[model samples]
Target: MSSSIISDATSKVKNMVAGEKGRKVADLDSVSQTVSPDDRITSDFGVKMGNVDEWLRVANEKKTGPMLLEDSFSRERIHRFDHERIPERVVHARGAGAFGNFRLFESIEDLTTAGVLTDTSRETPVFVRFSTVQGSRGSADTVRDVRGFAVKFYTQEGNWDIVGNNIPVFFIQDSIKFPDIIHAVKPEPHNEVPQAQSAHNNFWDFVFMHTEATHMFMWTMSDRAIPRSYRMMQGFGVNTFVLVNQKGERHFVKFHWTPELGVHSFVWDEALKLAGQDPDFHRKDLYEAIDNGAFPKWKFGIQVIPESKEHDFEFDILDATKIWPEDLVPVRYIGELELNKNVDEYFPQTEQVAFCTSHMVPGIAHSDDPLLQGRSFSYFDTQLSRLGINWQELPINKPVCPVMNFNRDGQGRHTITKGQVNYWPNRFEARPPATAQEGAYPEPPFNIQGIKARTKSDKFREHYNQAQLFFNSLSEPEKNHLAAAFSFELDHCEDPIVYERMSQRLADIDLGLAQTVAEMVGGTKPEKQTRANHGKKASKISQVEFAPAKPTIASRRIAIIIADGFDNTAYSTVKATIKAASALPFTIGPRRSEVFPAGASKKPGNGVQPDHHLEGMRSTMFDAIFVPGGAESIKTLAKSGRALHWLREAFGHLKAIGGTGEAVELFKLAFALPDLRVSATDEAIESYGVVTLSKVSPESLRESITIAKEGVGFLEKFLYQISQHKNFDRELAGLNSQVAY
Candidate 1:
């Protein structure tokens, strides 16, 4: 080729690349059409329509006759409506998605040459879908099941997907058993009695039969399964992948996403109550957080292991049921992800968004992990079945980069290629594949030594070690919760064989845990160990260890209960303080109508209106509750059983509780605990996660709201308690159990 011709071609390619760098959002906007009141109704083919609400009937206004089938507009509307529902996902069906950007804070050029990971200047667009694994599209969000944390990165190279889960491991080691595990955990095939619940006979029976599921089932039973919110959970790739550097040096990598808000979960009772009170709790929480400008963020990290030392660990690195303990392989955080925008529409954007584990850019490749290899094929196949052959052309799933290939048309094909031929090696040498030097995906050569057989490695046989490690690693309160979870699940299993086997199975991790669950579920109490406890522990396995470096109340929901005679000064000051701290404050009264505060007129405009009535919302909806002092307000609350239940339920759930002045007397009456202390003078008393000020004044309330280990002021102490996600001390001291919530 001539110099000038070559120069022009290179310049054109550079311009195209530059234009596609940050065009993901713009590309979607081009295909998106907004509805307006000024626009008229139109047919499927863009023809103007006058009457869409009524069908074309061959009759007068007085009498109706048979509808005319010749009306193309009516037929088209009916046909579209009839075929509107597409196939929902077989798993991870209940989900919420948001658009965001991934920014690399540190480059890992030496580990991998993938531009998205090695390029620090690029702000790669990302769409993340948070989901519950076993539920249908209509199921509740707070079920005790694994959460799907899938992310799609629209990088300049192409679209890369990290289809992961909140847990770091799987229920089974091999993909062949994927269907079996999911089938057992899902609603039973015969009755379909349980919806989005694992507390059943089949699940326990399956786990007992296949000991490999022990570790993952432990995670489900722990608080991890019922996360407080999608924004507060960790995401793990759960499968081992490979990264090849420029030198062709291969390394095994595991992906991690640590949330900035810290890991937290609802108490089992609270989760159960919220599932009925608000089935869309988690979905709405994600939307509300982003809409209120409190965008959720996570730090992206990777744990890399050289191929030469893959067998350095006792457990198989590629085993889907095991975790590469962070104590051994510390995560190297290199990037950050933030969800700043919600989807414009639910059907086209969130529902139609698909993910495949096979999607990858240059310098990244799948490992020989048995489960991962199967997922690469299964995910793509599932998408094809759900969204047709040309699913990739969907607006939400399309890549921003130029895609030039000889692939022809299929169902729902959107691209219109203008050319004489769609074949490679044509007479014009058109659209040839790129060379290695031009960013082509490199395939690292490896030797195959094993025979083709259906067998697992010896390391896969050792399953109980890690399960014991996880149980031993948890905090005391977490251990108690896990035990309670096991007991509850076993109790739900009507089959005696199922619960009895599971009870003995717990002995492999801890004898005390086995005995506790066995006694609670009417199983023969295990007196001796089934398998000796390994007595080993790993760090960062407990959610408590994932607490944020600094305390914060941002995005926390606080409820302010009041009546006709509530203290205006205390209420106003606390509400303003909560908003200033970037936390949400909701007013709750007997009714949604305006309620007169102390000395305020009983007029519509003069009184304060509550965000919700006591009967409309429960204490399960808020993270904390505050009651300001007023003689009449306190008396009204004391007389109402619902209001008393609110205080007790918050206390039983170990949530932060605050009260001032006469409110302290109401708390004492509601709790009725002689051991518990309340302030009597202008002092703040914080006891068992409850903060109260018996006397309130402007001078006392003027103190700064800085959180301290031993908070001096009332607001400081209350806010400090709120910052701590939960107070396990109350549960440990047996104070929460005493409450009759």
Candidate 2:
């Protein structure tokens, strides 16, 4: 596994940047491949490292742990490549981006003077990027990883970037060790294995060694890392930031984005399959939903800790890895945000959209978290290096409001700044005037202490309590997902040492969690946990608790499969009924259009339009499948393996499958089903995703329509069930003969 992963990791770099850098840079196991994957392997100067593995292996054995003078290729490559790549951000590097906007509801005059949140009418454009911290850009989205949920609000005042993630806490206390944690989590340099993931030896070794990552690892292994949709996941500003009110009173605040639809995640099985089926799944879903008019929304909330009580909590407010239980610090919802737009161009809008922790408006500012301070300096500098010093001038990074400043001129300066004088004290009063009022732009008056030295806060030492809290809070299935996630990641580790170390760390958080993981990972579990005060628990942290009290099929898709010589009216009614319920229905048949001839002439289609033909659609693509009544069509469909295969796939996916008319005969013939739940009338596919419609009322699309409109019985029962994502537990029944497509 290590060897294969190492080769794969090397190949990724080959794919990303061979041509752009002029030389073929090989030592890089980086994720961003600028060049094509299939492009010929080349060196920094376009030379090939033919049979690289054998060569390196042979040389290493020859040296026997020491560098030999004769191996110039290995020496030169590792040496130069050591300085080839710059440092990745302290957090949130492996992320995907999209363009959107945030419209305000009501002004929050009581909280802060931040223009973006205070203005009720302005529609500030934004580019939101969601990411995984431990993985590279090439990693799977399903990996149990912290999702970076950073949004840059191009407000009228300036750009206010709320850099956050799905998980509330972070891995470390201070910025001093930020580099160390990142280095440990990133692909190890010795062999440079493990592309786009943290289930490796070096990373686990670091976790066990440092012990600060306990809280974060718990989050990493949980289901939150494998979100069903970007729209459904919550976002949090990990650190404690400050929000100053109009009166100039400073309040230490934390930000939250509770999705209006509530939080949901993909089952681990589904997430893994999706990674292979479509690595671009989440990205595609977000884009398609935005395109199809299903705009995602979230309510903005803040938890303010008074300046006087900053030191009152048992745990430090500034610790990135610690979370203040909502029970203690209630989330006061301030405003709302809606992402109604898609990017015009991915490269210009999504790719160039830079989110810096330091991008703050006058009212909002950073805290004392060492990591955040490093971020303030890192982001702009990294952008300068990556997109040039004038990257802020780029359209996506540019502030919505006009930018006026004396600072000008740098590499890649696209705009030609006019005027002879760039200084503020110019004799010409033609320059933009500054507001004199303290409310206009006053900095919070806070005193600084001590000499400039590297020191961490004492509160940073408590890491396991929140980890325990998070683990203790999960529902049964959610906890199972976490254990499964740990197993999945660690199972990929080739080194037993790595697995052992990781297991010890896991044991520190939760012994059962560690034992379960180690059993699967082929390592010994620690007898006990090795952490300080194991802290409190909360019910609300787990997303399962947030399942909408009432389930609605608003955005769900149901497919009504049909064929020629079938009771067309029954199929049409069911289709129409689902539509009436405000759920989407697709008319699927043997072909794109299933024709119904009148009387004896009813043969092939005179002409019929299907929402999607069987070929264009699949059971995996929809929430449920229904077979309309038609004796002739039913026999034809039964004979054709495609029809049975369609239902089988739907069943395998745990989607609702219902039949009416001769369609009931097809179900009876479907003896090749496992754990079949033939509802007395209607059955909800528990493993799959919907309410199957059978016993169609041709005379009345009304009964089904009644069932549809009311979110009761099978509909609501399986609503949350289907939303659970992939049925990893499914054990399929065998086919006597393989069903043909």
Q: Which number leads on lDDT?
A: 1
Poorest 10 consecutive residues of model 1 by lDDT?
16-25
lDDT for each residue of candidate 1 in 277-331, tens digit (9 for 90 to 100):
9999999999999999999999999999999999999999999999999999999
Highest TM-score model number: 1
What's the C-alpha lDDT at position 176 in model 1? Answer: 91
TM-scores vs. true structure, each candidate: 0.97, 0.77
Q: Relative to the true structure, how large is the alpha-carbon lDDT of every model?
A: 0.91, 0.68
Model 1 off-target regions past 4 Å? 1-25
In the range 311-410, model 2's lDDT, one tens digit per residue, is 9988888888888888999988867777776665565556666878898887887788776888788777778766777888776676645455677878
Off by over 4 Å in 2: 1-99, 132-144, 187-193, 430-433, 436-440, 450-453, 525-535, 557-570, 577-677, 681-694, 703-741
